[model samples]
Target: MHSIVFIGGGNMASCIIGGMIDQGFDPLTLGVSVPSEQSKERLSKAYNIAVTSNNNDAIANADIVVLAVKPQIMRNVVLALAPALPKNAVIVSVAAGITVESLQSWLGSPRAIIRAMPNTPSLVRTGATGLFANDQASQLQKATVSSIFEAVGYCCWVESEALINAVIAVSGSGPAYFFQILDIMQSVGQELGLPEREARKLASQTALGAAQMAINSDQSPSELRDQVTSPGGTTERALNTFRNEGLESIFRQAMNSALARAEEMSKDFSA
Candidate 1:
């Protein structure tokens, strides 16, 4: 078994570890390095895995190192571990906007690295992750990294590292878009006379059910939507109102703005 070390024991790290453990990965091969004594204790107690405050010590035996630290501090964290990193050990970074090029520079070598864009839903083991591996990484190394993310949910590879920003806008920041829609729906339900609790439950369940249908059915979302939106019916009226208000154009502009911001972040973090 490849000994895996998590450089930061934050919620995302814990979720990945929990998913791996749930998939029956040996806890003996897993370890975490956390700065906080409380965090170290919490991870140890919760996962029954090795925990340490010394980052180097935690990674000494690791075949795969997951840099789960925030993007702003990722450079310092990478530099601190550069000396101790195993020559061939694969480094997988989950920090947003931190490119593989930046990581290689930080490490001062063409170390095998993979950049992952995973969303918040990962905490519940239903994440959609976008991965981009550096040229130094081999096929086996890519698969190894894929297994780690796949333990939680879906994994898709992009050809160019720059495409990671697109991934960030689409999947990494995608969950919030859904949540926003749900919030609006729930509020509308309340305005229409449902109790707050009932409004929330109804809106939430409808969203969930629609998503499930999209997944289960081979038909496109547009086709399914058309199926439900009969001419002169309530669904049709609501959808027509949305269309009349240029909802599609609004969504397009919003997503484009998101993509642009993600690109800006790439530049900011790379510096």
Candidate 2:
């Protein structure tokens, strides 16, 4: 088992560490560093992994270094920890908008680096992750990276780094979009006379069921949706309302905004 060190012990790191441990990865080989004593204590208590306040202490012997810090602070953190990182270690970054070039620059040397985008559902072992690797990274390194994410959920590697921004627009911010729709559906169900708890349950279970159907079926999502939307029926009437309201256009604009913001952040963070 490769030794893994996480540079931040925030929510995303916690989710990954927790997921990895749940999948039977050796907790003894995992390490995390956080600035706050309280955060360190929580991580140690929660995962039974090594925890330290010193970033250098965490990466000294790591085979894989996971950069989990925020994009804004990643440069400072990487530069500070560069000396501690083993020369042959692979760097895996999960932060959005932080490019591999910036990481290499901060490290002050060429290193194998993998950029990954993982959503919060990883906490439940149902996440979707997107990854991209630099030329310095080997096939074995890429496979190792894929296995780490796949343990938590689904993972795919994109051919280009630009697609990482697409991933940010889709899966990275996708959960919030789903949650917003579910919240609205739940509220509407309550307004339609169901009790709050029952309405929430109904909406949640329906959402889960629909997602399961999509996953289990060979049919495209549009085909499945069409199957459910009968001619001259209630579903059709509702769909017509959505079409008239330009829901598709709204979603397109929303995702484009997310993509644009990600690109802007990348420019802002580039070294």
Judging by lDDT against the true structure, name the best candidate: 2
Off by over 4 Å in 2: none
- Candidate 2: lDDT over CA atoms? 0.92
* Model 2 Cα lDDT, one tens digit per residue, 1-271: 2389899989889988888888888899899999999999999999999999898888888888999999889999998999888988999999988998899899999999999999988878889999999999999889878888988899999999999999999999998999999999999998999999998999889988998999899999999999999999999999999999999999999999999999998999999
- lDDT (tens digit, per residue) of candidate 1 on 28-100: 9999999999999999999999999999999898889999998889989998999999988999999987878
Question: Against the correct fold, how does model 1 do in TM-score?
Answer: 0.97
Model 2, total clashes: 0
> How far off is residue 179 in model 1, in Å?
1.0
- Poorest 10 consecutive residues of model 2 by lDDT? 1-10
lDDT of each: 0.90, 0.92
Which candidate has the highest TM-score of all? Answer: 1
Off by over 4 Å in 1: none
Error of 2 at 145 (Å): 1.4
